[model samples]
Target: MLQKTIHKSVACSGIGLHSGKKVRLVLRPAGENTGILFALQNGSGRRFLTPRPESVIATGLATTLGQGGDSLATVEHLMAAVRGLGIDNILVDVEGGEIPIMDGSAASFVYLLRMAGERTLSARRKVYRVTKPVEFKREGKLIRAEPCDGFHVDYTIEFPHPLIGRQSLAMQVTPQSFTAMLAKARTFGFLREVEYLRKNGLALGGSLDNAVVLDDYGVVNTEGLRFSDEFVRHKILDFVGDMAVLDAPLWGSFTVFASGHALNNAFLRHLWVNADEYLEEVSLGLEPVAGLEAEPGMVTASAAVLA
Candidate 1:
C-alpha cells in the first residue's frame, strides 16, 4: 500500500499539561520515507525527534519523548489521531514542550486532519505484523504481542477507585472502528488526586475544558461522558497512539494487563528489539504509497523502531 499525508497544513493552540505554557501545533504534509518527525518550534532551539516506541522516555502522566536535553510530553492523543487516520507521513511543529491537549480526545485532531484533507504519496506503506509471540512482564503488569490473522487487542485495566474498578476492551484496530468507537473517549483524572498531581508538576494546565475530572464517586465535569465506557475507550485510544511510535501501522493481537504508558512503550520496545517477529505488510494492512488502498505486502523488518 502507498503512504498518505495531509494535503494542506493545519494548526491548533493549547496549554502544556506540565509546563503550563501556551503551545501551538502545526501539522503539515511530508514526503515519502520522511516518516513522522516532530520539530520544536521555539527559542529553545529546533530539535526533532521521531516518535519511536523506543524513544519513549517517561510514561507517568503521558507518553513523553526525551532525547539529549529536550522532550515532548502528552503526545499519545495527538499520535492516536495520526495513527487512526492511517496517515504515515506528517510534520508536527510544536512551539512549546508539549502538544496541545485539545478537548482531551483525538477527535479534534481528526477534524483538523480532515480539514487539511489527505493525499496519497509515492512510497509504499509499511506495517509491523507480529509473526511470533514476544512478551514483556513488569511487576504484575504484562503485555504480550502474538501472531494473529489481523491486528487486534485485548486490554484489561484495574484501579482501586470504585468507579473504575476493572475494565476490559478488545477490538480490531480499524479506521472505521476507531472513528466510531474510540475517537470520542476523553482523558479522565481524579479530582482528589488533582492536588498531588499538581504538586508533582503534572497536569498543571489541565482544566474542565480539556479533560474529564472524576470526584470521589462520580464525575465532576458539567458535561457527562461521551461514551458509557469512556474510560476504557480512552485507554484504547492511548494504545493506538502509542503504537504510532512504530511510524507505521501495526498488525497483531495483543493482550495487555494493567499496562499504562510505560508498559505500552516497553511492549513496543520488545517487538522492536526482536526484528524477526514482525513483517511489513504494505498491501494488506496499509494504504498504498501511490494513493491506492492495496493489499498488504509482507516484508521482514530489522532492528529500528522510529525516528
Candidate 2:
C-alpha cells in the first residue's frame, strides 16, 4: 500500500492535560519516511521529536516520549488518531509540552483528518512485519508479539475497582475498525488520581469532559458508559496509538494481559532493538491480515504432522 498524508494543513486549540494551558497545534503533510514527527514551536522553527519506544520517559497519568531537551507528553491520543486514520506521514506542531486532551478521546483527531481529507502518495508504506516472536514481562504483566497475517491486538486489563475488573478486546487493525470500534473509547482514571494530579500541579486540563473518572462505587460522569468494555477498550486504543512510534506501520499478533504504558513501551523496545527478530519490509495489495493459521497454500504444518 502507498503512504498517505493529510491533503491540507489543519489547526486546533485546546488545553493541555497537565499544563492546564491552551495550546495550538497544526497538522501538516510530511514526505514519505518522515514518520510521525513533532515540531516544537520554541522559535527554533520546528524542532523534531520522533517517537521511539525508548523515548518513553514517563507513564504517570499518560505516556510521555522524550529525548535530551525535547519531550512530548500525553501523546497516545494524538498518535491513536494518526494510526486510526492510516496517515503514514505527517508533522505535528505543538506549542506546549503535550497535545491537548480534546474530549479525552481520539474522535476529534479523526474529525480533523476527515475534514482535511487524505491523499495517498506514490511511495509505498514501510511496514514492520513480525517475522518471528518477541516478548516482554514485568511482575506478571506481559506483552508479546508473534508472527501473524496482519496487525492485530488481543488485550486484557484488570483493576481492583469493581467497575473495571477485567476487560478484553481482540481486533484486526484497519481504518474502519479503528474509527468505528476504538477511536471513541475515552481515557479513564480513578477519582483519587484526579485529586492527586491537581495536588501535584498536574492534569490541569482534566475534567469530567475528557476522561472517565470513577469514585469508589461508580462513574462520576453523567453521560455514563460509551461501551460496556470502555475501560479495556481505551487500553487497546492507547496501544494502537503508542505502536505508531514504530515509525513504520506494524503487522503482528500481540496478546497482552494486564499491560500498561511501562510494559507496552518495554515490549516495543524489545521489538525495536532486536530488529533481526521480528522486522520485515513487505508489500500489500489489500489490508494486511493480523493472524493466519499458516502461510496461504503452504502445508508446512501438515508436513510436520505427517512426519
Question: Whose TM-score is greatest here?
Answer: 2
Candidate 2, residues 39-66: lDDT per residue as tens digits? 8877656678888888899988789988
Could you give candidate 1's per-residue lDDT for residues 147-216 as a string of tens digits?
Answer: 6544588888887777788999998766667788898898888987887888887788888888888887
Deviation in Å, model 2, residue 220 alpha carbon? 0.3
- Model 1 Cα shift for residue 100 (angstroms): 0.8
lDDT score of residue 132 within candidate 1? 72
Worst 10 residues of 2 by lDDT: 298-307
- The whole-model lDDT of each prediction reads 0.79, 0.82
Give the lowest summed-lDDT range of ten residues in model 1.
285-294
TM-score of 1: 0.88
Off by over 4 Å in 1: 277-307
**What's the TM-score of every candidate structure?**
0.88, 0.90
Tell me model 1's lDDT, rounded to 2 decimals: 0.79
